[model samples]
Target: MRKSFCTTAILLAFGFVSSCGVAWSADAPLENSDCVKCHAKVVHENQADGGKHKTEVGCLDCHVGGHPPSTPKEDIIPQCSMCHSGEAHFELNNCLGCHQNPHQPLHIVFGDDNVAACNTCHPAQVNEIKDNPSAHGEFDCSLCHHDKHGYIPDCMECHEPHRPGQTYSDCITCHRVHQPTNVTYGQDIPNKDCGACHGDLMDTLAAGTTKHATLQCVYCHKDTHGYLPACQDCHGDPHPQLMMKKFMKCTDCHKDPHDLVK
Candidate 1:
């Protein structure tokens, strides 16, 4: 009878606190920044400044309305749909799951977030950036995609332009969005995946006298994978200087610059 009376007393106390709008914590869970310390710098690398984390908006402020497990990998973070009521995008698809980190929140490189995301407005480089394996694989999608849907970023808007010979008239010529690793060449630029576009180049390597014939175009065009070679850089006497001067344009004599000495 005494134990039952005590249980009733505890229930009445809990209800009174609940009715008073006061929260009862198991213990005060760590604030957002405190969580980041042990969680490492993996969550929000970009929000170091006056953004969400710096504003003292803790993890519980955003990761609310869900019960995350005690384990790290097993912890299911609350979806953005929970408290991101102020923002709007497509439907939720475990955004933070595939997206991985939220602190940097926009650098998606896996599927089509790279060159193509920018191409919704910058259509010029869409196809080329999509094909280059080296274009999208290395970087984060949010690095270039600073805006939401259909928003275009000027080249200098987010990043600086190129130098002397390296400047790209079309960013897609060398820059890819989806996977920085898969780049395609342009119209003026001869395509040379060796197997994909330059099957002829592969055939020559297969039946050639030189061992180099066995190599792919990308093998020689290393460094920046989307980059091509200048005939002037390699073989000193690759062609007659006098004839080259008269032509002014190398494509006239070379047919396809990638084909070379045909």
Candidate 2:
């Protein structure tokens, strides 16, 4: 009975109800309304862009132990690992570095230098840039994706197009931002894009009377940059075997594949 009296006295000292043989006021859990009264802005921010936190959790879920007056400020605060464990991203230190606000976890932001931080969740893109070294690979991820997380800057922001009036879409069609130097494009790429670098070859191909003039540069060159296909790969032994033996190379007679002689 003395122990019960002591407990009741302690509860009363902390401004809790003093009724004996009844439910102790300390046992009564704090409602969402109780938290909202003090932390309306935090609650509102969480509801606005909380992602899963607004739907899956509540006030008491994270901020446990007790509120101030009964518990210290740090005692009530929760760590990210309390709920977000078991993943490589979760294991990473300094959740606040990128997340910034616990209320809106998904609203990620990056500082001027966050390449190492970016590599945690985006290892594929980071690895791709590292493996394939280009001018784009040398800097931090935030240099390109500045202002906000997931923001993809236009290639034209840092680089001039190969031709005038070329859009960001056109730049990505040939040059992947991560590995920009290794130029590759599809069949739909026009001859004008090739003309940007090889104007002489493009002019020669355009002026040629052969069927090759009707084809796109990619149609002959195919997948990647600097690929030179032999005439035999397309037009195999147009002449007799005796003539082919005498002239093993097609270019020896044709002179130029771009402007073939009739």
- Model 1: per-residue lDDT, tens digit, 75-168? 4455566556543232534465445556555544344454443444445555454455563435544555543433545565645544323334
The deviation in Å at residue 197 for candidate 2 is 1.2
Considering only N, C-alpha and C atoms within 3 Å, which residue pairs clash in candidate 2? none
Best TM-score among the predictions, by candidate number = 2
Per-residue alpha-carbon lDDT of candidate 2 for residues 91-206, written as tens digits (9 for 90 to 100): 77788887888889888877777777777788999999999989988888888999488798998787788899889888888888899899998887889988999999999998
lDDT of 2: 0.79
lDDT per model vs. reference: 0.48, 0.79
